[model samples]
Target chain A: SQTIHQWPATLVQPVGSPLSLECTVEGTSNPNLYWYRQAAGRGLQLLFYSVGIGQISSEVPQNLSASRPQDRQFILSSKKLLLSDSGFYLCAWSVLKGGGYTFGSGTRLTVV
Target chain B: TQLLEQSPQFLSIQEGENLTVYCNSSSVFSSLQWYRQEPGEGPVLLVTVVTGGEVKKLKRLTFQFGDARKDSSLHITAAQPGDTGLYLCAGADTGRRALTFGSGTRLQVQP
Candidate 1:
């Protein structure tokens, strides 16, 4: 069985601080990884997706950038965080054809 | 860009009542998926309807995909308290890797 692990369940960062959120999948190789953000009382927005290592496609350009450093590891980072960056971050993984996904426990970040 | 719109942004219903959630789109899609997200957790996929006019039943939940593959519906029979959560519908745009998700529907079944 595959399980996804996401770190820092909750965080509070000051404005202009650096941020790093990591997501990793266990028991799956070369899986498609995605990064999503869900604002309070809103839908999940796709921020980045990677089909393979070092192949990240960003959906919305902003202060955030995503990197797939390994086969099952996807990272979302920001050099200087903005107040609007505060939201619940979710990580998801899926295989080639099957559209259904398994999501990791999200990271809730609040920028002050 | 393709967009999915869900109806009934929020619903509060008593247990044992029946309810339906709809997801619609103007553009056709290859497939549509339904997911349930619990508070403080990620969304869990409930079902995926691939073929047009396909209907799949999981216990009390019945999901149907429209013939044109542009819409889908989920009907719950005698809903229970455990059925309370956020319901989301996502569609796979033709030739796109990412699924376009609807705004979502929040369902609360009070016992």
Candidate 2:
């Protein structure tokens, strides 16, 4: 069975600080990865997605960026965080053949 | 861009009651999926409907895809407190690799 792992399940960052969240999937190769953010009392908002290593697509323009450094490793980063950047960030993976997404536990970011 | 709209954005009911959530879209889809997300957790897949007018059952949950392939519904029979969560509907279009998700419906089943 495949499993997804995310680091720093919860984090508190100061405004204007840098941010980096990591996501890794085991038992799957060449899977498409996605980054999503959910604000309090709101639905998910897609931030970025990658089809392969070094290939990334931005769904919405904001303070965050995503990268696929390896076949199973994805990273979401920001040079400087904003107060609006505070939200629950999620990482998901899916096969190329329209498979349903498998999501990681998610990282709750609080930018104060 | 495809858009999915879900009705009854927030629903609260007692356990053992029945309820239904609807997802509607103007664009046709190749497949539709239902997901449930608990507080502080990512959404988990509950069911997927492919063919037009398809219906699938999982214990107390029943999912139905519209005949036009542009809408879907989730019906919970004898709901339990454990069913309290955010319900989301996502659609996969033909030749598309990504899915467009609905805004979501938050269901609160009180014991």
Candidate 3:
């Protein structure tokens, strides 16, 4: 009965503005969490993943960073957003290695 | 890093037609998974093939894993409009915890 919640469903931010997208999981403990970004036409790209709190592994180097403030809460942030940062962001969790992952509803971010 | 190549980047077929999509990789995988994603939503797990040369059927969809553990295929029989979506193939290696996903195949089944 695990579920993930990602918010602000839709966001529009001005260029060089700050950004923060939050994701939290319920009904699971110490699960592997991941962040993915999907751009138009291009497929989903892995941004970051965490095996535990404060243990984030970034896959792609960009103007973004991730933090696990709590066991189930993950935050994606950027000091200054860029036009290229717009995309559909997804959060996912998995209990076992190489196992099926349950994804969140996702957040659509548009950097103007 | 394992790389998966999915062909037929885009596919459009009429309902009741049969089609097959492939996923090939140069590196061996401990497991392979297929997912379906709709617009405005995250991808959902469809099936996972573990054992080499394993074939699993889910209703009208069939999945096959290559004997060398380096490739896989998905076949849909009598496809329906509901089957239209983006199909992605991901492979996992025993040495790596993360999965390497293919670019993806966008499928459209016309009603």
Best by DockQ: 3
Point out the worst 10-residue segment of candidate 1 chain A by lDDT: A96-105
- At residue A37, candidate 3 shows an lDDT of 92
RMSD of 1: 0.9
Model 2: DockQ vs. true structure = 0.66
Worst 10 residues of 2 chain B by lDDT: B92-101
lDDT of 3 at A50: 94
Worst 10 residues of 2 chain A by lDDT: A37-46
Off by over 4 Å in 3: none
Which is the winner by TM-score between candidate 1 and candidate 2? 1
Q: Write the per-residue lDDT of candidate 3 for residues A18-51, one digit (tens) a residue.
A: 9999999999999999999988644678899999
Give per-residue lDDT, candidate 1, residue B8.
89
lDDT, residue B56, candidate 3? 97
- Whole-model Cα lDDT of every candidate shown, in order: 0.93, 0.91, 0.91
By DockQ, the better pick of 1 and 3 is 3
Residue A2 of model 3: what lDDT?
86
First chain TM-score for all predictions: 0.97, 0.95, 0.97
lDDT measured at residue A107 in model 2 versus the true structure, 0 to 100? 97
TM-score of chain B of each: 0.98, 0.98, 0.98
Docking class of 2: medium
Residue A9, model 2, lDDT = 95
lDDT for each residue of candidate 1 in B1-111, tens digit (9 for 90 to 100): 788999989999999999999999999988999999998899999999999999999999999999999999999999999999999999986587888889999999999
